[model samples]
Target: MSYTYDYPRPAVSADVVVFDSSTDSILLIQRKKDPFAGSWALPGGFMEMDEAADATAIRELKEETGLVVAQVEQIGAYSAVDRDPRGRVVTVAFMAEASTSESIAAADDAADAKWFPVDDLPELAFDHSQIISDCFSKSDKG
Candidate 1:
């Protein structure tokens, strides 16, 4: 069953911030596609029709970085009108912890995946820089 509407709707996506507490670093993936190709960004993608935001985050993480996370805490939702270049995309961001001992290999839409110190990260794609900053701010308070 399908329905069509005259009004437009924003696309939804999910992003994950995988922090390695032991090293004080976070996981980043080099995008393999345009709109930010070669730039570092969080592991994420558009949500599927059958899955929830959190599930999308976990799936994208595993597909792009080869790291599976069982649990994640919701950071928040980003709905800035100009957030995504492709269109009006609202992203739900999640945070998770992974052990440095776990190995990650770039796959799917990611050209490369690696860890970077939270304070010394490279220029990130989209609104990721802000998202990461927000995550840290929230964590610092708790």
Candidate 2:
């Protein structure tokens, strides 16, 4: 079965905020493409048709940062009118914890990958700063 929409729909994506509690740092990637190219961002991408948001988050984390996350929890959803330069994109953000020993490399749309202290991070792309703040809020409550 197939259906088509006459009106435009917001594209959905998932972002992962991988935090290393031991180092008090978070993994961020420098984007290789435009729409904030060269800027730091949480690892993520658009969701595939056969994938759920959680799976997208996990897959993107691995694809962009070469880091395998054991588990991810939904932190929040962000859908601002002009958040994405490409289109109206709504993103579901996920949070995970990793050890300081975990290895990471840049891949896919990532130009570079590294860990930044949570308190001292570079300017982030998209609405990632807000997403990270939301993730921190969620963690404080749990």
Candidate 3:
């Protein structure tokens, strides 16, 4: 079977803001590819055809940082037309808090993965700066 649409379809992606409560740090990955290569960003990527947005978030987090968080809550969705330089991409953001004792290693499309204090972060890629701000604000209240 084949299906096609006359108009363009925006791609869907999932991003996760992982906060280490023990150290008050957030996980960030250095992008290994273009569109923002070498820039720090949240651990996330495009959803797979067979997975839900939430599942994508979890999977991306594990793939990029090797950190397995038990629970992740949806924060919000970002749909800025120019959010992604690759094309029109709509991202669903998820937030989670974990312990800094958990182990992590960079993999997949991430050149490097590390934790940064919420008060101090490197220049971020995409609209991650805004996403982190929003996620942090929500976490602060909870």
Estimate the TM-score of every prediction.
0.95, 0.95, 0.93
Q: Give the Cα-based TM-score of candidate 3 against the true structure.
A: 0.93
Higher-TM-score candidate of 2 and 3: 2
lDDT of 2 by residue, 1-142 (tens): 9999899889999999888887889999999999999999999999999999999999999999889987799998999998999999999999988875788999999999999989999999999999998888779622
Model 3 spans with C-alpha error above 4 angstroms: 1-4
For 12-35, candidate 1 gives per-residue lDDT tens digits of 999999998888999999999999
lDDT of 1 at 35: 92
**Clashing residue pairs, backbone N/CA/C < 3 A, model 3:** none
Q: Model 3 Cα displacement at 65 (Å)?
A: 0.8
lDDT agreement with native, every candidate = 0.95, 0.92, 0.91
lDDT of 2 at 40: 98
How would you encode candidate 3's per-residue C-alpha lDDT over 53-72 as one tens digit per residue?
Answer: 99999999999999998778
Reference-based lDDT, residue 98, model 1: 95
